[model samples]
Target chain A: MHRRIVSLWFPRLASDRILRINPVEAPFAVTHHEKNMERLYCLNSQAVQQGLVQGMGLSDARALCPDLRTGPANLHADHHFLSALLRWADRYCPWVGFDGNDSLLLDVTGSTHLLGGEEEMLEDIHQRLTHSRLHVRSGLAGTRGAAWAISRYSKGIVPQDKLKIALSPLPVAALRLDDATCTALQRLGLRTIGELMAMPRATISRRFSLDVVRRMDQALGDQSEQIEPEAPKISYAARITFPDPIGLYGDVIAGLERLLNRICNKLKRQESGARALRLICQRVDQAAVQAELRLARPMREAECILPLFERSVRELDAGYGIDQLRLEAFDVEPLPLVQVDANTAHQDSGDALDDLITRLGSRIGLDNIIRFLPAESHVPERAFVEASAAYTSPESKWPRNQGSQRPLRLFSPEPINATSRIPPRKFCWRRMHFSLVKATGPERIAPEWWLDDPSWRSGVRDYWHIETKQGRRLWMFYTPRHPAWFVQGEFA
Target chain B: MAELEQFFPLEIGRAHEVCGAGASAFAAMACGADRSDNARTILWLQLDWQSDIVNPVGMTPFCDPSRIILARAKNQQMLLSCAEEALRSGAVSHVITELYRPLDLTAGRRLQLAAEMGKATGILIVSEGMGSNAAQTRWQCSPECPTSVSDGHNPKTAGLTVLHWELIKNKKGTLGSWKVCWNAQAHRIIVVSEACQ
Candidate 1:
């Protein structure tokens, strides 16, 4: 396959990333604070129109235009947004990589033909990017270095044979050299790349840095340069664009079934199962509705997934008509077939349990569903912790009642009014007085000092398993320092 | 034993309502009726009643509190729809819903049909009044003794909570009223006295 590399440079990425999230029409600049001084890190078109240059001190930039608005530069968010753009560019080619922090490199050698000729492919990219309101400069060449320089220096594609001529008019900065190197070359009267190339190779290597010669050689294709493509993502998506706008709910369900079947087929081929599936219905009016189903176990069967959507399908409001339907599965796991005899009617109860989990998870929310897991702690509240069933599993069997019995029901500590802490012969709780019929010794428990628990701020607790005369088994605790008694739990 | 089985058993694929002021007591009883040896997940659909959480320790004797899921709906319509959706989900073996007011026949029928379709049991715990609907059985329960003294051998143990219930409507059998108690040792409901025929 012929190497057809395309490079896209995002000049206003820092500011564009911010504006894309928060769109404001006023003149704004992303500022950076350095050494107790603030300076402009990036400027939008509005700021640029007001003759504001980047790297200028904040005070000076404000002087140029008194109404200048400033925002703190977020390099992290900018890099994240650029990575998303790189993934978006995968539609054009599989081999896509970040050129720098703000640019992308795509190897569309065999892929460009899929979208008509190379010229039409570039036009498609340009048009779509412009539609998204992102300002981009692009170039295509035979080498990564040439493509990088052409994108920053010149416009459009450069033929492999005409690489030297195309790069000659560009300045030394086009080779992506450091500022000090560019200035040193400029002082030596090597202003244009053409002048640098005319000089003897040995002379250029000795006077300027070896990097200058290497960058020139790489750009001219004398030495090959390779790009590190972005890591390929495992995508499980099945999409269908309608021939005509479908308005009916039945029609939408039909579309969903088709997509779901496709996804299940794909998953079956890979010997994997999906834990979560998302359905996106794009309407004719441009409003899209999404319905997501989370599974308790990895599932690949269409019958299992289709019914889960049945309850949530009504919420998918196909405003006007849904013209496109897409189903994407996430968190896929290997689901090897479990060997079982045909005659044995032992259907995996796991499947039934999973169905229950999925149904309850979707309706009541997966977070609300909980499972009790024995935590490695001695404290009563910390002895067992409730975990979201969708995420965690019970690791250990609950410790049995050996010497002492624990309450079946526990509540957040409620203060009890008791006759001055003498094992509470009588206590007033919830506006009702209870006489202690039987009492167990104080089970002293110390707080985990290493961990800061607001509830355990009282230091140590002496717990008692007491039965009230009213037939209520009460688990009460007394604090030594506070000399107070409180009811923490009750037996069933 | 035969009479206890006949007492408003929470049959799968059927819709039942436990009405009157003591809805929570009957609701807890319905949850205890889950017959699966392996505990099935439970979803509590909260509509009008705000506080339905049992004493955490108290739940241990009845059902695994860890398997309980709590969901709150905005209005009566949403609550009914949510209940219908939960019944149709077939996710849980049983769904215990709290209804502040009686549902109309249409809404109740929809819920019943959904329960049948999903192959799960629906237990509606309604507060006060008896609005007629399509449920297979309607029960009226109230706390009777709350702490009735069992055989005085274990006086230290808190007294058993006794409930009086009347099977006001039973589509499959004759109506009856009986007294039942929470057997702390068995973690289940046991009929203490004979039913009044």
Candidate 2:
């Protein structure tokens, strides 16, 4: 099979993209900062005709063309436009790839016949792009390198028999060599492709790099070059349209059930589960109403997922009636198939727990549901960390600390009025007076110096387990240096 | 029956209430005592407005902190709904909730029915006074001065403080009160003194 590659180059993509939206007739140039200097990145045809070339400093360009209008170059926007063009070029060839930021390479092998032969296909592509006001220069040849060289330096088709004669007049830079290598070749008087071709292959390989010889061989069809085509994105969405608009809740649920079955079956085949799903309900006389569902864990079962959407779907106003329903499964994760025995069918409690968490999270947020994990810190406040139950896996065991006693309920430290430091015979907390019946004291703990904890700025603390006459067991601490006391927790 | 006499046997598939200052401590002890080899998960729920949180380090003396799942609800309605949902799932062994206000009879009955349906225990730690509800047991827990040390300031018994548990209401058994303390080495509550009514 003969491989015919097409190269399409957009010479002024950045400048033309701006001009297409806000049409400017005067000479305009797009400038970008490079090496701490503003250089002309792309030039419009009007600016080029006024003797302003790309890479010229903005100051020099203004001197050359006094009426030159300048705008900042948005390379990101230009790249996105070029990608959209690549997808648009899919109509001419199935295999199309990006060549640099400004060009595209399409291998239209045997499919060009569908658009009435190779010449007609090129003409069609040129007319369509020009209709969209994009400056496109295209070349078709037997090899990718030859097509690329002809597209930038020359335009038109290159015959297979006259490939050498066709690329001979082009400069050595046409072979995609580095600036230094091209300068070196030009210094030795090897300026054109024909002159470099006449040199001995051994000397060229020894003196220059292997790239020079490889590029020449690839252009002349001796070495094969492959173009990486972009693959189409696969969307995991299913949609169903009813012949007549259905408004009842039961009818809508029936339609949702069918859609869920279709999407779940697709997920099962790929061994993937949906973590987040979106449902779009298209109405007859109004715009679409949408609802979203988030799962605690990746799930693919239709039965388990259908119920989670029931409340949200019921709340969605059907307006006049819903004529179409679309279900899309995003945030997909790989969930390998698990083999279950018939004897253990009723013993899968993990799924039930996850389902419950998902239901509760949809109402009260998943962040509110948490589990405790032990932290390696002596500071009482930093001793434990909370992890979301919906996201984190359950730990098997917690590391046991056989240290000093800790309070059952911990709260922000509240200052209490006490007369003396020794467990205060009488103190007031939360506007309530309590007299201490028994007191255990003075387990001194120092703050971690490395951490500038605001609560620990009171210096070292001496803790006490004090029981009150009113049957209140409180965890009290007194700062020796600050001479103050605070009630921080309760044994309850 | 004799083996269960030493410890308060919280009936499975039923609702219970604990009030007063040491309710949370009593709930933790009950959860630890009822935990078996298969039953591990305990769901603990609290209101969002409440500033106090359960310290994992403190809970380690009674229950394994890793076996607990904590949730905070915005209001009482959400808390009760979440408790009922967790109980009805049958995924956890026990569901413990901290109620700011007293639970009504209807809400308590709903929780009881859900617990019975799922075969899980439900424990409510109420802050306010208890109302008439369908709970199987109601307890009042308070702290008691340590009697082991005469001076009440001995360093040896510094970490050992006793709690007084008064079983004020019981449908299945007689009312009683006992002074108990957590034995860390045995991982169980031991009775220091007992009083029957």
Candidate 3:
């Protein structure tokens, strides 16, 4: 049974063309991106002939060949281009995935028959990408890693099992050990995969690392090597265009309505609600700026989203004008289909209504809005946390003991200015004076000693509930370390 | 839990007599505290934006109480997002946005009525100078808690909070300035007792 696998390696893809630009014919190397002002990852036999040697930096490379052209790598663009090739490669094999960052791997088991044979299928994939200005190497073997090693190390028309032999002579770098590991291996004088294979099992296991053994097993098909494909992100967005670019900020509001309607319609179909919205304004000079809105609830409705865009109009840079308007639902949460009773649903709860929230969320980033989360701790300060507008589901209770009314705000522990060491009569704190009338609690809260965190360096805290003659109730605390008293909270 | 939400009815006394001519500032004041002391107790909530935050309502349904608490941010769009967060906290009387510049009168009226009907208080926290334009009461405030004090050796950091509020304008007799100690952990503020001092 033939397995049709296609592999493409764009080693000199960057340098091959620079040779044509200025005609620096002899040994000039093509360099990848620059690390700094000087160095370049040189592609040399092609480079050295043109006075471009192995150790030259980009500036040095450029100086080596005065008229040499340089190209910056575009990884995202490359991925897009790679995806397009994958689409085209479907004619040869059904399973195709990327390998080693710059190569494509395909499994053509049971597919080669349609393409005439293994050779023809390989030829077909190679011809297609090459026709589209991409270079590839074809290798066929029983295993994925073996094929990979053969493609990287072996010569043209590598027959089956030729790789098992060829791989032995190839450097350990072919096993994909990172630079540091490969350099370490080279320093250890175990340069080739053959040397690594020859090393004692105990020594390689104890000295080198597990990765070396894992790579060997994968190459020999003793272990499975799986390629994780990137999952396509869930994106919900729609756009509209006008005959003439709309310049007025008010004009965009109407368009936003249309886009919002479309977004809501799509979300409704999916039984989902949007937590965030991004308004992309495509302007002149190919410029685009996105205005976003975050919702506190999983919401879907034009009324909820429209008013938000109304507020955002003031922030938009309505340059030469917006030729295209796009509204994308950025963060999404599954909207559980709700059975809205006609009575409660239709009953107008208030004159202002809930539209204000949607309006506001879409205007600012979703995260900017936050709600308080009740935490598990009783340390007044640790009792609650600030939550994002859409991260949680609604709960029924404040989730706390209903004994005392909590102050609407809590201050970090502050010094309590008092005349005496004990709970004093009156004290000055921050230019103000106060006297305590009622008091409770010296609840000693010790820092958890198990987890040593620096912030808890002050050993323990003793809390007190104190009321002042002026009718202000306070949750004051005294640190035992220096025996200092300070006010921390006030009862509402 | 539902009882707690209703515990604070988004309502103030006087049987729904709306405050001054439907301004955002007026509506916020009309829904002010109803204590007999005539001191409209106010809570100043400050937040830090450094980490991941959960949705308030999701954590507790009480946060979605009827009170409409509007929030003001650096920009108009930011107002909505902030209000949604306040709404989830369960105790805001109404959400009122005080913008840097005056908006259309209809929008202000819409905001005021929306705030009142929800039994929530709407607050327009405009720039200190801007609120003066439409506010029934303008407050010139200093920290209620003194942060630190000067020690004989170094300027010792004062740990207590003390805020002084002066009512620059009001429909009733001018309320004298007040000095209150803030207790953050308990989320309460206390009126300092001069006699104890």
User: Best DockQ goes to which candidate?
Assistant: 2
lDDT of 1 at A376: 72
Worst 10 residues of 2 chain A by lDDT: A394-403
Candidate 2's docking class is medium
Q: Residue B48 in candidate 1 has what lDDT?
A: 33
**Which residue pairs show collisions in model 2?**
none
What TM-score applies to chain A of candidate 2? 0.74
- Tens-digit lDDT string for candidate 3 (A11-121): 554444344345554554544555555444435354555766544677767766776554554456556666655565566666777775556677766777797877776
iRMS of each prediction: 5.2, 1.6, 10.1
Task: Enumerate the candidates' DockQ scores in order.
Answer: 0.20, 0.58, 0.08
> What lDDT is reached at residue B78 by model 3?
47
The number of clashing residue pairs in each candidate reads: 9, 0, 64
lDDT of all predictions: 0.77, 0.86, 0.55
Candidate 3 per-residue C-alpha lDDT over B1-197 given as tens digits, one digit per residue, 9 for 90 to 100: 01211211223311111111112222222333222332221212222331211222221211221122222245553443354343332233444443444444354444444444444444554444443332334444443222221223222223343444444554434434554443333433344422111
Q: Which ranges in model 3 have alpha carbons more than 4 Å from their true place?
A: A13-39, A42-93, A109-128, A139-244, A248-274, A298-307, A326-358, A362-365, A394-408, A435-443, A448-459, B1-111, B116-197
Model 1 Cα lDDT, one tens digit per residue, A366-452: 665566666677777777666667667544355544556566545688888763656777778888778876677789989999899
Candidates 2 and 3, the one with greater TM-score: 2
Worst 10 residues of 1 chain B by lDDT: B48-57
Ranking by DockQ: 2, 1, 3
